[model samples]
Target: MEHRALGRSGLWVSEVVYGNWLTHGETVDRATATACVRAALDAGITTFDTADVYALGAAEQVLGEALRGVRRDSVELATKVCLPTGDGPNDRGLSRKHVLESCHASLRRLGTDHIDLYQAHRFDPRTPLEETLVAFDDLVRAGKVRYVGVSEWTAAQIAEALALADEWGLARRIVSNQPQYNMLWRVIEPEVLPLCRREGIGQIVFQPLAQGVLTGKYQPGAAPPVGSRGAGFGRAPRFIGRVLGDAVLDRVQRLRPLADEAGVTMAQLAIAWTLATDGVSAAIIGATRPEQVTENAAAAGVRLTPDLLTEIDRTLGDLVDTDPTKTADMFAVKAEWARA
Candidate 1:
């Protein structure tokens, strides 16, 4: 696997980060989860990302078990906070109480003393930004979290946090931001990508394949494959509906020719495209089977030529969504905290 610096930080991670978003605890059994993790490691994937809220933290527990014999320092393990792990009001968000408690719990669940990177799963509007930063700073100082990041944070939200971290002389600035990025979803491009590039924040993009739509597995005007993720087996079927439409699927079908010309599968072509994006540090892929891990990992070092990339752009020109308005406010406090 190819390795890259994680957004101007000293840390380096595999270009293809193995993530367990919808597979680990909920969709697959323990044996399959362990086999996939082992396959990822065998494929030289050094970064693994999960969240405390995934399968109610069972994902983390399963991931931890999978990595039991592997050397801890050899891989970069990351998890997130600010998601409700329980019903209590204090069980969620970036509040100090929740942040500290969540980190401790994550460490225990992951069977690691320190998380290589701990991220804010979403912007916590109810909590002060300074409070959140300070809590993460404390974790860093206390040797619990090595670096801090945010997921699905708007460009404006990241800027505010960066400025505050500078002002407070915190232990670490946000090193990364995780967002849903793919050929079809360019919401992060117009603003988030450029700002993050300048601020030295690397984007660890999730859903790089548009949740497998880019794989060309879903045919236009046909029912989704019986056992596919789009067939209602995975989590968050609501968002998949956007990409499963006939219009989008037909456009995606056009990319198969390009994939064939490149001597790669449609999935590899799509993954290679994301890795080629300027500000991306890693493209997270969630796999259910071991062979799937190996197949996607092939894109780690595959480079697309300028002509191929241009052809891809032209084929999917109108289909792309770069309007920038599609960027969602996960915290629901855009009016109060967003910059003008």
Candidate 2:
């Protein structure tokens, strides 16, 4: 697998990260999940991303077990905070209590002493950013986390945190931002990309395939394939709804010709396209079976030429969501419950 720096930080992550957002504990059984994780490791994927909210912490447990024998120092593990893990108000948000407590819980669940990247899942409007930053700073000083990051934070919010970190002389800077970025979902392209580029923050993108819409599996004007991600299996339906429409599927179908010409699967083409975007450090992909890991991991080093990228754009014209206003507010809509 190809490796790139996590922003300007010394840490480097695999170009195509293996993520267990919807698969680990909720969708697939433990054996399947473990096999997929093994597949990722065999494919040279050194980076793995998960969240405490995923499967209500079972995902972390499964991931921890999956990496049981692997050397901890050889892999980069990332997880997130800032979502309600319980009903109590303190159970969620970026308050110091929650952040610190969540970090400890995650460490125990993930079976790791330190998280390579501990991200703020979303910008907490209720909690002060200073409190969040200070808590993250404390984690680093305490040697519980190696790096800091935020997921789905707006450019303005990221800038404010960066400025505060600078003025306060925090122990570490936010090195990464995890956002949903793909060929069909370009909402992060305009503002978030530019701001992260300027601020020296790398983007670890989630849903690089638009929740499987870009894979050309959801047929236009036809019911979704049985057991597919668009089939509303488990909690995936909540996030897959936006891209399951006939209009989007029709446009996605047009990309198969391009994929055929490029001699790559539609999924790989979609993944490679997202990796081509500016300021993207890595693209996170989820899998149910071990074979899926091998299929998606090859996109790590596949570079698309300018002509193929242009062809893809022309084929997917007007279907792409580029409006800066479309960026979801994690605190408001909750459209992306799986991630920030």
Candidate 3:
């Protein structure tokens, strides 16, 4: 597993970070989660990313249990806060009270004293950015967090946070953003990627396979696999436009030959595609099984030729959104090289 610096923060994470999303408390058993984690560690995946709200906090507890007996120094643990982990008014948002409280809950669940990277899972409009940044700074100063970051933030929101942090002379700085990026969806290109590149902030994208769509396991017009997330994650409810509409399946089908030629699965190809770009610190891939971890890790060595990359992009066809006004544009970021 190759390591990359996570933005301006001195911390380094594996190029392929492990994530626990739908799998932690739903599809995977404790033994299975441990096996998957062990496989990732064996393959040198040093970073494990999870959110405080996943499975209503079961994911964090399970992850902590899974890491038992493993040397802590060998792995990097990254987790997020701020997603209504509780119903109380103080339970959510980046307000200083909520931020500090959430940090403690995550810390207790993960069984770790300090989180390697702590992120605001989404923008909290109610909380002042000044309050959030200062609270995060306090965590770093108090040795509760090593780095601070934001997720699913627009470029403007990210800029505002940076400006506020700079003004405050805070102890921590925003070093990374976690967004969803894949061959089928590239909204971050125009919205957030450019700002990251300009500020030297690293990016670790979530859902790099479009919530299993880019894996090419689900053919057009076919039912989702039994016991799979798509069939079971009805409550999670993926956006219809991104997941079901616009012939995403057809485009995914066209990539089969390319993945085969590279001696990898479509999932591997999609993950590698994200990493091939500069400023992507890591591609966080979640798995329900150990084999999926191995399959994704295999992508580390598969490099797409420039011609192949261009061909793939052209075939994928305008999946990377350029307009900032569209809701989908939040997902499709403008590529730094994209002609405005």
Candidate 4:
């Protein structure tokens, strides 16, 4: 797999990062999860992403076990905080107590001395931004976290945090932002991308396939395939329902011919399209089976010509969501939940 520098930092990550979100410790069993991780390593993927909120921290345990035998220095492990890991008030958000305790808990679960990248899962409206940054800076100073980042944060939120970090002379600034980006979801392009580009914060994008919609497996006018995420096989992600509409599915079908012309699967075409975008350091792909990992990993270095990209845009015209405000809207929803 080809590697790229994560923003302006010296850290390098594989173009295709294997992530376990809904699969590990949720849908797929531990043995299958380990197999998928092995497939990722076999494909030369050195970066793995997980979160404390996924399956209420079971995902990290599964991922930690999967990478147990691999050389510690040979891989970059990333996880997130700021999500509720329990029902207690202190169990969530980016408060200093939560952030510091979460870091130690994540370290114990991942079986690592320090995290390669520790991210704020979401912006905490309930906590002071400086308190959050100070906690992250403390983790860096204490040698628990190497780099700090945020997920699905608005450009304004990021700018405010960066300004505070600079003003306070924190040990580390944000290095990356993890957002859900795909051919269908272009919300980050207009605002977040340009801001991060200028700020040197690379994007570690998730759901590059639009929660499997871009894979063209869901039919336009039919029930979702059995056992698929849309079929709700096992605790499906809530976000997948938004993209399962017939309008989106019909437009997604139009991209199949383009994938055919490129001599790649629908999934590969979708993933390759994300990598082609500037300011993207890596695209995270989750897999239940090892062969799926192998198939998606092949998209890491595949180049899409300008003509093909234009054709894709033309085919999916008007079906894409490009509103920059969607990021803030999502943040607001999460913030309300935090208040509750």
- 3 versus 4: better lDDT goes to: 4
Better of 2 and 3 by TM-score: 2
In candidate 4, what are the lDDT values of residues 182-245, reduced to their tens digit?
8877889999999999999999999888778888999977988887888866656475766676
> In terms of TM-score, how similar is model 1 to the real structure?
0.95
- The TM-scores, one per candidate, come to 0.95, 0.96, 0.92, 0.95
Q: Model-by-model lDDT, in order? A: 0.89, 0.88, 0.81, 0.90
> What are the runs in model 1 whose C-alpha is more than 4 Å off?
234-236, 329-340
Residue pairs in clash, model 2: none
Q: For residues 208-230, could you state the per-residue lDDT of candidate 1 as single tens digits?
A: 88888899999977988877788
User: How many residue pairs collide in each prediction?
Assistant: 0, 0, 15, 0
lDDT score for residue 7 of model 3: 77
The CA-based lDDT of model 1 is what? 0.89
Tens-digit lDDT track of model 2 for 259-327: 999889999998888888878999999998899889999998899999999999898787666766656
- Regions more than 4 Å wrong, model 4: 328-340
